[model samples]
Target: MKHEMGRSDLLRRIQEVEFVALDINLYLDTHPDNMEALMDYNKYVYELDQLKRTYEMNYGPLLNFGFSPSQYPWRWIEEPWPWEI
Candidate 1:
């Protein structure tokens, strides 16, 4: 993330984190006593949020709720959708 990454790269990282979290979540469902797995799940979820915010700030809302009042008009609509990239 230190180096400038393309939009797709950031998107991919977000997916990677989510994927990790999803697996951990499934494991925790069966092994509810695994505190370590719970911690990891929280970590990945946090990372995913950070990445999504960063992407949305520079690009636009990833979801309808991602809008953060902007001084420059509602330019979120101008940005190309993720798949359009």
Candidate 2:
């Protein structure tokens, strides 16, 4: 299912996965014994993590700080601001 994804598409996929995880999280809050939901949640979370890693590698930090490492004098600052583009 993997293909060349632009930044916007990748961001959309990441958000979609996280939203699914969040809904599952709410379901689990009331039914903590649901192993099936738990497994689904875990799968989505792992996919989200991989997406984030891919995003960071190709397009700077998805976050404003913290998750991004100081690889080369904070190149994130040089990336085009979302509002500017």
Candidate 3:
């Protein structure tokens, strides 16, 4: 089932995923032999993938997929204006 999340909520979630990915990436870089960190990093990566998929499926694709999928011609539209939320 899909939940109707506000644009701000989606943005916040994506930011969280980015932060976790960065943290895990840095940990792995410094402690390459740490199995637990590696596992956590993998988990975070999977979460990030899922989050992206959810956002794209619910809203429009966050990044261009090389071709447009919208029924009408599209232009870059900013997410709900920052102040509107």
Candidate 4:
């Protein structure tokens, strides 16, 4: 049966996807003409965005400093700090 992912699971997924996207980004910097790599990069980027949005919606804002919007009473402050998470 499918199970719901916890906060830490979501965070881990985001980190993994982000790492893959960054690695592909660096590769593309050296091989700009690689269509396959470019396509892969785009796919991963889209996945990363979706994952972050899901995480934020379930938990809270993943970022501060105007990167992520807050809800009533400033929900960002309600979530645990990054280190605590």
Best by TM-score: 4
Best by lDDT: 4
Per-residue CA lDDT of model 4 for 1-85, tens digit only, reads 1126888888888899899999999999999999999999999998888888887777788888999876666787784854477
**Cα shift from native, residue 32, model 4 (Å):** 0.3
lDDT of 3 at 3: 41
Report the C-alpha lDDT of model 1 over 1-85, residue by residue, as the tens digit: 4526678998888789889989999999999999989999998988888887787777776655545533266756776876577
Candidate 4 — worst ten consecutive residues by lDDT sum? 1-10
RMSD of 1: 2.5
* Candidate 1 whole-model C-alpha lDDT, 0 to 1: 0.77
Estimate TM-scores for all models.
0.78, 0.84, 0.69, 0.89
Cα misplacement distance, residue 28 of candidate 2 (Å): 0.7
**Candidate 3 structure lDDT:** 0.68
What TM-score would you give candidate 4 relative to the actual structure? 0.89
Better of 3 and 4 by lDDT: 4
Query: How many steric clashes between backbone atoms does each model show?
Result: 0, 0, 0, 0
Q: Rank the candidates by lDDT, best first.
A: 4, 2, 1, 3
**Clash pairs detected, candidate 4:** none
Q: By TM-score, is 1 or 3 better?
A: 1
lDDT per residue (tens digit) for residues 1-85 in model 2 = 4737988888888889989999999999999999999999999999988887887777777667576654466766866743344
Displacement of residue 43 (Cα, Å) in model 4 is 0.6
**Per-residue lDDT tens digits of candidate 3, residues 1-85?**
3346676787677778789889989988889999998888888788777766676555655666664343233522646433344
